[model samples]
Structure formats: structure tokens, C-alpha cells
Target: MTRRGVIAAVLGSAVAGHIVLGVVAGGAALTAIRAYAAPPAEPVFPAPARPVSPIVSPRWSTERARNDAGEARTVIAALAPLNGRTVADIGAGEGYYEPPLAHAVGRKGHVIAEDIDAATVTRLARRVRPLANVAARLGRPDDAALAPASVDVVLMVHMYHEIGEPYALLWRLRRSLRVGGRIAIVDADRPSGEHGTPPQLLACELGAIGYARTSSRPLGDGVYLAIFEPRALPDTIRVCR
Candidate 1:
């Protein structure tokens, strides 16, 4: 064999011996090789300076109870004139507002029900399967994952406090809103750790990312509605503590 061919043969034999030894050693060597050969896992964005509440459960409360309290109706009313508008329900756990929003928006309009949990997204998809105007999909903790300039209204009901990367999420979500679009948030006036966001803290966090509050009003029972519109983003984001 030529010198090059001889060198190749030796290398091949060494590799073969390594595999044979790996097999004899119960695959530990092979596992180590594979571990080094595998690509790195995807990186996740870090949380902002503020505290993020843990997601306790998918359902905030029973549908019957919320309905009885006129929660959905009040929130829908706060978003007035929903007809022919594209609306997105971010972190849409259990999709409590999908049907009513679908009805309010009419057949000409559309509703996107999005959640971060895969199982929740699957359930939402099944629940809204009959509604032709609604689409259910999965999202990420740090992103809404909606189309650019596609929605006229974004509803974040009882879930804003649980966003892990609130700053990054809101910054990315601004691209999804159309001209004259607004984000409607319904949360309790409490600390984020308590499954609610205080109105002042919410304003500070959103304002840091260039979202201006269009309106803020009480919906009773500790829940409040705050509407925000996107403005020019600052060159550097100043995270709220």
C-alpha cells in the first residue's frame, strides 16, 4: 500500500478498535463520543430585572364563575367595536374568551388563541376547532409568535404576571399590532408574585419598551383593564425593577 493508504488503514483500524471497546464497556465510550458530537441546545433569553410569577395553573378560575361575574363581557366591552378586527389572546390558557371574541369579531374577523404550553395549545386547538374564525397555536415564553402587523387588538387577560421574559415578549409583540391597534391587559392590582401585576408596575415595565397607556380603568373585584399602544422604541431598553 502507498504511504497515504497505509496511514488511512491505521486510522480506520484505531477507530474500529475504539467502537469495539465501547461495546465491551457497555456503551459508555460511545455515549461520551455522541455527547461531544451533538450540537448544543438552543439558548433561552434571560428574564428582565423584574420578578416573574410562576404559572400556577392553566385555568385562573372556572368558566361558570367568571361568566357569572360578567368578567368576559366586561373585558370585551372594554375593547369596544371588535367587529371586523383581528384579535389575539396571548397566553390564552383554556381559551375562555375565544368563543365570545370570535362571535364579537364576526365572520369577517379573526381570533388567534395562543399559549406557551404545548398541551394547553393542543386543548385550545380542539376547543376552537368548530370556530372557523379562530386559530389556536403554541407560543414561547418570550414571544407571542404572531404575524407582523396582523392583529388589531391583543388581549392579555389574567396572564401577564406569569410572563417569564416580559420585556422581550412585549418588545417582540409590538410588531404584531397593526396601525391603530391596542393591547388590552386585564390583571389584578397586586404584585406579580401574587398572580397579578400592579397597575403602576405594569405601566413602568411597558413604558420601558415604548408602549404608551391609552386607557386605564377598573373592572371591579380587584381586576383592572389597561390598554396600551406601541410608540417609538428607545435606543436602549431600561428594564423596570
Candidate 2:
């Protein structure tokens, strides 16, 4: 072959060899293209599958659930007997609910005050130290980090909608409940971003998470109480879809 033809042939052969090995060339140099599989496609996160109507705007302060016109009385009425049992107050800001929950659970019982923020947990840990029966725990966006089958009741007061990963969180939370443990939610009937979740949407999410809404009652002032019992959930959650 002519000198130019010989060089072209060699280069062409090099490229053909690479193609046979399944690597694509990117530059004019005859360097071997590393056959790399495209990095595994990123996982697609599940999105809210359905539209559940929500209520309106920044939620009420922790004080709202703490008082809210006898809310403490309302919560006490909704739960199973509080004496001698374990209770979880999720998103337990300022540890406001821990004292009462501890009191209701009695000295024989225990109350776990949980929050996702480390600062919040630190403060809560110190806040509940004097309560004896009350303790603080640090949780995650998708898990409350409570021990398995540890709590008799989970109080999601005014913070259900604030759960950034509700499906995963609730699914995992089922393992934290005792045999007949129950969940309680107290939220306004507004949009979630607005810090509210409508009752119907609340029930749907609970059912999806393998919880059955057993009792629901008006707590007045736009807030309502919902009690749910743990049930068998499917192998995979469908999210809001």
C-alpha cells in the first residue's frame, strides 16, 4: 500500500477493532476507548401519584397542638390507655408534648421525644431529662429510628405533612409499633406545603402505609384527630399514586 494509505488503513483498523470491543471513540488519537457502561441510570424517586386536596399556609406553632382549645384532652381521649406504655412524639419541637405524654404514660411508662434536627434533639434531650419517664431521640427524614416494636403509640401532631418522605417513613414506622400499637395525627385540613393535609388525603396515605383509620373526630378550630392501627403493607408502596 502507499504510505498514506498504510497509515489510514492502520487507523481505520484500530477504530474497527474498538467498535468490535464495544467502545466508542471520541478523539482523533488512536488511543483505546475504555468500554465503560454508562453509569447506571439514576434511580427515579417515586412522586406523589395522586392529587389529594390540601388546606392552606405555614402551620400553626407548636403551641397550637399543645393547647389548641383542650387539644391535650382530645389527644388523651384518642389514644389507648396511656399508663404503663411507650409513646412517641414525632417532630417533638421544644419537647412540648413530652411532659404530658410522659405523665399520661405514668411513671411506669416511657415517652420518646423525637426530632429530625440534631439541634432540636439535643435541646429536647436536655428538656425532658427532668421528666424522668421522657427521653429524646434523633430521627431521620425517612425513619424515626425507634427500636422495633417499641412504642404503643406514635403521636404525629401537626407534623404529618412535614414528613419529607412520608411513604418510606410510615412504611418503616410500622416496624416500630408494638403488636397493637396505634398512630395518631392531628392536622388542619389545608394543603401540605401550607403545613396541612386534608383528612381524606391523610386516610389515603395511612392506608397506603398499611394503617387503617379506626377513629376520626373533629378537634375543632380546623384541626382533626385521626387514629390508625398497623396492618400488613404490600411489599412495595405506591406512594401518592
Candidate 3:
């Protein structure tokens, strides 16, 4: 074959290779652009198996329940200004806090006591029957039973971390609060004592869900209380504590 012919063949092959490279590069760039423009997928969280039957038995001792009730009364007193307004207690176990809150809110105000366990809700219903303003509802893993924007305050006491779907629950709680509403999340420094939620992580999660840490106080003997208010809500018109 002639030298010119060989050179011409080499040039043709080089051009074809460049064309292939250009096509591959263009395809990759288009794929990257499409990926960048697409909206992110929603976060997926695992759902634990629900109990076949609700845990109805009182989890706390009678004396312990009384102590908890007393502590709850103090907290409700601190939230005294929210009187005469609708409120929801998320994870209201055994209806311990409902009676005190019911007394605080009086007849005009309502308390929606919610728990994930149906048996607990039944127990709470019976326990709070004397208080006409208290209503018991079963909450789901991802949602509470309260109406959107219907509550003046939402309270979660020593129960936020036990929720399996914390983010989803927080979103639900956020929607439940009224325009000027407040959310008071009270958890012990050690939730379960042995393997409880770390206070710092709780604060971080609450902050992510638009709660501002307003105040904290030591309850007694290694237990600390933290108060958080919704960042989007208006300032407290009347300071209770």
C-alpha cells in the first residue's frame, strides 16, 4: 500500500475515535444535568412492627405516677398563660398528665390526650371521664390524632425520643399548632435511665423541626427539664413562668 494511503487510513480511524469519544462525553454530560435537575427523593424510614395488643397495664408504680403527676402539674403551671386554649398531649401515657392539664385549662379549654397504644387510650378515657373537656385519641406512629392548626399548645413530656418516626411526628405536631401556638417538649436528661436519648441530640432534632430552646431547669437528682417553643409561632403574650 502507498504511504499516503496508510496515512489517510490512520487519519480516518483517529477521526472516528474522536467522534465516539465526543458522543460518549455528551451522553455523560446530559445524564449528569438530568440528575442535577431532578428533585431529591423523600427520605425513607423503617417502620417497626406494631404491638398485636396495646400495652394497657400501668407502666409506672402508683407512687411514681403520683410523683410524675406532681411534676407535670408544675410544668403545666409554668404554661399557665395557655389556659382557656385547646391543647394536645402527645404520648400521654396512662392519662397521668391529662387530669392536671384538664384542671389547668378549665371547662372552656379542651385537652386531646393521644397515645400510640389503644389500650392506654381506653384507660386514659376512663381516667379522664370526670373531666368533660378531656378527649382521648389513639395516635399513629407517624401522625397524631389532633386537627391541623387547631391546638394552641402541644405538649410532649418525656416521650419524644420513644417515637419511631420522629421527623414525621414533628411535622404532624407542627401542623397541629395554631398561628400563635407553642410546643413544649419536656424530656428527662436520661429518658430510660440506661439507654435514653442524649439531650444534645434531642435539642438538635427539635431545632431542625423549628423549635427554639427557651429555658432549661434541673428537676431533681440527675433529671433536667428543657423547654422549647416553636420558632415560627408568635412570641408568648403572657409569660407563665
* CA lDDT scores, all candidates in order: 0.85, 0.75, 0.68
| Candidate 2: regions farther than 4 A off | 1-45, 49-68
lDDT of 3 by residue, 39-104 (tens): 223334333222122233444337576575567767787777756899898888888778778888
Per-candidate TM-score against the hidden true structure = 0.80, 0.74, 0.68
What ranking of all candidate models by TM-score puts the best one first? 1, 2, 3
Instruction: Write model 2 residue lDDT over 98-203, tens digit each, in one string.
Output: 7778778998999988888887788878888899898888889788998877888989888887776677677667777876688899889887766678899888
Q: Point to the candidate with the largest lDDT.
A: 1
* lDDT, candidate 1, at 209: 71
Error of 3 at 219 (Å): 1.2
Clashing pairs in 3: none
Which structure is stronger by TM-score: 1 or 2? 1
Best candidate, TM-score-wise? 1
Clashing pairs in 1: none
Global CA lDDT computed for model 3 = 0.68
- Where model 1 places Cα greater than 4 Å from the true spot, the runs are 1-46
Rank list by lDDT: 1, 2, 3
